[model samples]
Target: MASGEERYQEFAPPPALRPFVRTIWTYAAPDPSRTIQRIAPDGCPELVFDLGAPYAEQGEDGVFRLQPPALFAGQMTRPLVMHPTGPTELVAVRFEPDGARDFLGFPLSAATDRRLDMVERLAGFAPPPGDPAGQVAAFVAWLEDQRRRTVWWIDPVVRAEITAAETEAPAPTPASARAASAQRALQRRFADRVGVSPRLLRSIFRFRRVFDHAAHPGEDVEGWLEAGLQAGYFDQPQMARDFRRFLGCTATDWARDQHALARAIASQARVAS
Candidate 1:
């Protein structure tokens, strides 16, 4: 982690076609009195560095709680709990699922996908706390180098299929025709690249979107449901199941909890007790 005295390093994603997959630098002040935690029910993976603090990672408990200045480069297949000791600072590369696959050189299903979990494999790598800045600088330099290289590494046939699907703009027919065409193209692309059809992905995406929207008082549920439907769920039941999978709760319950948590964050600057 770079010290407050050293400099706060922030990296923004380049502007272009794949804007959503941008990797940015994140920083925080060192505070001995505070802990930072994150949880992911949807199985989103991340790359992080643990500067050099004592930390504990819970196994078989479905939760990972860490005490920092430790550096880690890993993926979270389940929920995680993190704590920072003495106001730590660190650089993280956050990636979406597809972008993560591109960056990691392995599919998400690969057991050895996490770099930190196989520390021995990362032999000759930088040590923790003392060299995070150099590590991040090296990563940024590498990403810049890769940016000048090729695009879309899938097989030629798969790339053709992807290009065709993305080109299938909504037809000029009736509303249903446009919707059906768009849905079909998205489904094909998702199956080819993401290993899941757009129908399933949209259900998950919609459920997550609804939860995020309803994470406040006086939110409109009916409107949220309509939005979910537009995002391609067969109906509300499918969407609800998605909520259960990623959030470990029904839609309504998850919304309430998020709202309460947000209120607490805004009120006293506290983490979950």
Candidate 2:
């Protein structure tokens, strides 16, 4: 088995593509253990091109379905559980929160929690044939071509909401009447473009910060009370609630269990930034 560091790598997008593409990443696990991996939600959609043995995702019914070689993974509100079928190699594009809509030319809400075959969803799309690096280059070129042919526009309100959700500013107060009204208007457009409501996106963003805090050098569960506060949680219980909601476990339990593979991928992959 490759070490976590060797198993994953992330590459930045070109300047012109940065606004739409968050990052391109590759993961290879040639001899993975028979352990199920739980991937937490991060409010971004992905285009995955599997180059080696496929992985199987567990559906809500608890049945596992083999993933397609090339597929679009839409925004997920709950954790996704998957186990390897054999050796695995994947090169994937992580799109910005609202970027997939412009590329897919459909309402992202239609894709939430769904993985659509890329070739079926996007005409003429296919998994680029090459090694990981060459595949990434080919995919980026394809994306650039698509950008030129497509007329793309992002809603300003959604942009502002994403910015506010990702900020480290103090937990926001209750919304004002006018702000609430504006949020209602934004929710429809946000859901159409981003696959989740603005409030849900904010919750997911805040939930991700808990991991960031726990990852800091010398931080541990002993200090999670403070970590939770810094992560915009009102208290440890509030943080624990979110941890349970998103991870299906308490923070302490999650730490004790040591989900190494999931942690490694989450730490290395810049899904939304």
- TM-score leader: 2
Where does candidate 2 stray beyond 4 Å? Answer: 1-5, 121-131, 169-174, 177-181, 213-219, 256-261, 269-273
TM agreement with the true structure for every prediction: 0.52, 0.86
RMSD of each: 8.3, 3.3
Error of 2 at 166 (Å): 0.5
Cα RMSD (Å) between model 1 and the true structure? 8.3
lDDT, candidate 1, 1-273, per-residue tens: 334432244455554413324354444444332333334332234555545343454445556555333233433333343444444445555544344445445544442223345334334545334344565665565455554563534344333332333333232232355577776764454443444443333333444444445445455768767867765567888777665665556656644544211222222211110
Error of 2 at 161 (Å): 1.3
What TM value does model 2 have? 0.86
Could you give candidate 2's per-residue lDDT for residues 140-178 as a string of tens digits? 988899889988777776776687787854323334634
Worst 10 residues of 2 by lDDT: 169-178
Report the Cα lDDT for residue 176, model 1. Answer: 56
> Runs in model 1 with CA error above 4 Å?
1-11, 15-21, 25-38, 41-45, 52-58, 62-88, 111-138, 144-200, 214-218, 234-236, 251-273
